[model samples]
Target: VLPAVVDTAGAATSKTQVHAEAPDNTVFNWHLGDKGATEAAFKAARHVTRLDIVNNRLVPNPMEPRAAVGDYDQGEGAFTLYTTSQNPHVARLVLSAFIGIAPENKLRVIAPDVGGGFGSKIFIYAEETVCVWAAKKVGRPVKWTSDRTEAFLSDAHGRDHVTHAELAMDADGKMLAMRVHTTANLGAYLSTFSSSVPTYLYAPLLSGQYDIPAIYCEVDAVYTNTAPVDAYRGAGRPEATFVVERLVEVAARELGKDPAKFRTQNFVRKFPHQTPVIMMYDTGNYGASLKKALETIDYKGFGKRRRDSARNGKLRGIGFSAYIEACGIAPSAAVGSLGAGVGLWESAEVRVNPIGTVEVLTGSHSHGQGHETTFAQLVSDRLGVPLENVSIIHGDTDKVQMGMGTYGSRSGAVGMSAIFKAIDK
Candidate 1:
């Protein structure tokens, strides 16, 4: 165990380092947008609100934990691995290219009957790597399955941040600018997309649903003695939303206005809205959504409801939380520029049988997102076939075409979108 000799006063420097390569336990440092523009906005604003927020860490506790089995085909001189990975092709790529286990074509990966993976099973883990290596050496199938305790010990964790944010507003309460400084705890190692999440995913989303004119963000990714951090559920978008929306609410409270009204007043009211932080929202009706929510919740009757609850010896209060996230798995070229190791595209192949049945092959390995029913529906609706006539095939790289796999809630967006395009072709 690493000695606990760090100072509590200097929280940034005192922690015991987990990796020798990362001295002082720093993983990455990243920034975005113009600091000058942010400064000017703050200087020109009539009001400024500051808040510090911490989005607590999470362990992705899927029903069935991570598992893998490896075997070698002696006749063909090939290897195969069956694991509960979200992206088997990416797993194949890492095992072949980076891990140096074998060449790409020589490896056949099958991700069979996985129970669930809420963004945690999307990486190449060490146990599976060792199993594959050991199988070739021992000339037998090597299997490894993680129990709940082992999953807690080994699975990539998510969303640990200590962040400070400031929002600037004009005299009329229109938002002018925003700035954020976040220290992200990346745990022990950079698990797959860990280096990119807090920077590319978090910073660009600092604007949230608001129409802030200028925004600047900085993230200091630090390593600690814990499981490596990675994408969990909404990943960085949730953390970014917490900071921006909390600021919006706190600012509304400071200026003596309804939180809903304040948010609606600053809503991005145009198509192709671009935030200073590197995101271009093509189309949205944020004001309309807020209006519908307020009306549905009966915002005007809050006082009466609170009084009634107090009479009954209870306390009641309404909360308004508005947020926006950039989903659709992002753009490949755009993310590539931001230093992503892989592109952000999914793959699919539609095989039409001569007997009028259909078999669809996709890169997405759906443990619990219902790809079998959903992807089948996509083909059924498009090809004019009955749902039963279409069968979805995935998870096996030897059978399915190469793909980026699923995360960021992209199974419907990019994965199914790829299947739709394949149908068109």
Candidate 2:
């Protein structure tokens, strides 16, 4: 069970009461209170059958780190930033507010040739702000790139969570209720989306593809001594999937049932099924995908293969993960209601040049997602113009007036959808 840190001593008490300070030298008298309270409630109800705990830590290995460069024209009162960014215009707006910069009319951000962001490039980093501030300071262009180790300590990390998951199933191997209590590590400070990542992004995905009738999840986002944890690749979905899949596997083994068969029986077959969480899933064929995967993997013939491997003194096991994800983010209002500081809407403008050529500017910035080619392909296909004639431009705040940068696989879905609409006009 996950133990939540409820309280701690504020200051120096005594020599005997003094414990070692955290890695960042933040010292306090530590106390562990309200530990396992959720688990206790579950146990008292007799609804909890299986419980599992998983703890994750941070890993910072930097090859190509973050870098940003900004340019401002004192004459035109405009600004531009060329750096690694997931969303440049969003960075411009946020940095403008935080740094007490001039109106957004005087600011522009450009994300150019970012190598690898993972999830690090998604934030409005201090380095980006410093560059813009320094450019005005030095009266020239300013560039700052994160070294390997700076990226480790400064760049936001991901997936530091301690989770307690419980699954209740009936005698005939049907899941009745699933409950998850997670204590998410928010590090020393709250980063851009740190608070929402664990609660809205992670916990809501616990429903997976199961047809369970009742499910409840609560997340306690707490401060700790480490880098802020945010989105990484699949972000919260992967952790949620891992917990559900692992628990399901263990439950199947305990019930002496074939794992695949158990999952097949519990698959959600209807459309627009609503989970106990906030999400209402759209079109999906969970059973069809599971059946197709079983056929491709030859699930019935696995026994023969396992026996053959046993003869060779090697234990063989086959595992399956049937999961569903919520991608493309959501409507701006939908995400804003969940405590998001900014809107999640994307922006794009298609400008037709005098020669009937096209310039497509988007709020989404692409480090390695190939916005130049893919966006051009989309324009060419839609406008019936030559691919070379359609130039996709992004990462400049001046070019695209407003934007919500890319993350949560929202670039293609939200950003591209905006581009398509603009081009159609």
Candidate 3:
């Protein structure tokens, strides 16, 4: 179902309808999903089955919130910003474009003592941009830090989607057709990975591990009077998994079969399985994993446990979930094909010092992901060097050349993959 974007005045009058108008110079088309003609089709669909409306807006409540200290040197006309960020190089590029500053080389970004991000500190915030511009404009050092409340209201939120899904099954309980209509809340502005989250990340995973033959999804990303909704943890995959797995379980219950058996029966037991939603799973052992889990949990004994619980006047239900996730940020071509504005490739540079020590500079910044230890271990394992002899450097724009930053569980798969390439070179 398409969400209705209304002004404060329009919402007061009509609560459930979208109004479209020409974009003015002050306002850009920042809505999440379809626009123009595509939006018209979403508004016309009838018979929405499973309506999921989520409106829990969580602002970034970092313990230290957000802080930025900037200094511009008049002699070189260069600028440096110390802030809490997962990717300083990306921030510097964004700041240069937004505030009309110097190129990336002239802008140095340092992330020092960042408390926690939880996906909020990954973006180039307006506060950071303004502070850096003010430092250069006023010809003095400028510093700005966000209070707890400010962080709460301004920090990006996650997973605000209203969705309706329907599954059509055949006589043997095989899923024949599936359809989903979603209205994703984009808040006021579109965050960096915001638009692609619902469309590419969310929709592509709708196929799940099941062998559903036909599937269709229509997502209408809406603009709401709230904070921007972006990636959090598993991002769109968790939301998609919730819908697909829950529906599969419900279908199993309706068919009067064990959820695990039903899933095993429908599981795609093949490699390079292609779904209708444009994702080709490289490899998986669905039935093996399910069987192993059942053995681990003593599936046969659940009936006795349930009966004992019933005698004690307790209603207990045991549920099993077997899910498959596609992570590792993916290839650049894959991301670009799916309408991503940025490249998904990571960067790494391995340099051997004159004293026989090794240094690795990576684009993947670590926010408690333990890059120092893990990266060093990789270097030690690969080059036959001791872990202590390798030092991994990151999160500084001046220290690294180019980077796409880290998120989407991509640090190990994409970032380390890049590091491996560097080591090989």
Q: What does candidate 2's lDDT look like per residue over 305-412, in tens digits?
A: 999999999999988788877788857543565655465778899999999899988888787888889889998999899999988877777677788777788888
Instruction: Write model 3 residue lDDT over 1-425, tens digit each, in one string.
Output: 55545332233234544324412101222222222333343344332224343434445576878889889999998999999998787898887776667877789999854767777778888888877779988999999988878877888888776667666665677666567776676666778778777777887788888886667777666665567788776778888887787777877887787898988988887777877777777788889888998999889899999999999999879876677676887575556667765767899999998887999999988878899999999999999988899999898888887887777888999999999999998
How close is each model in CA RMSD to the real structure?
Answer: 2.0, 5.7, 5.3
Between candidates 1 and 3, name the one with more favorable TM-score: 1
For residue 362, model 3's alpha carbon misses the true position, in angstroms, by: 0.5
RMSD from true fold, candidate 1: 2.0
Q: Which has the greatest lDDT?
A: 1
> What lDDT does model 2 reach?
0.72
lDDT of 3: 0.75
Give model 3's TM-score versus the native structure.
0.87
> Model 2, 93: alpha-carbon shift in Å?
1.3
- Backbone atom clashes (below 3 Å) for every candidate: 0, 2, 1
Give stretches of model 1 more than 4 Å off: 5-11, 330-342
TM-score of 2: 0.85
- Stretches off by above 4 angstroms in model 2 are 1-48, 60-62, 70-79, 332-342
The candidate that wins on TM-score is 1
| CA lDDT, every model vs. true structure | 0.85, 0.72, 0.75
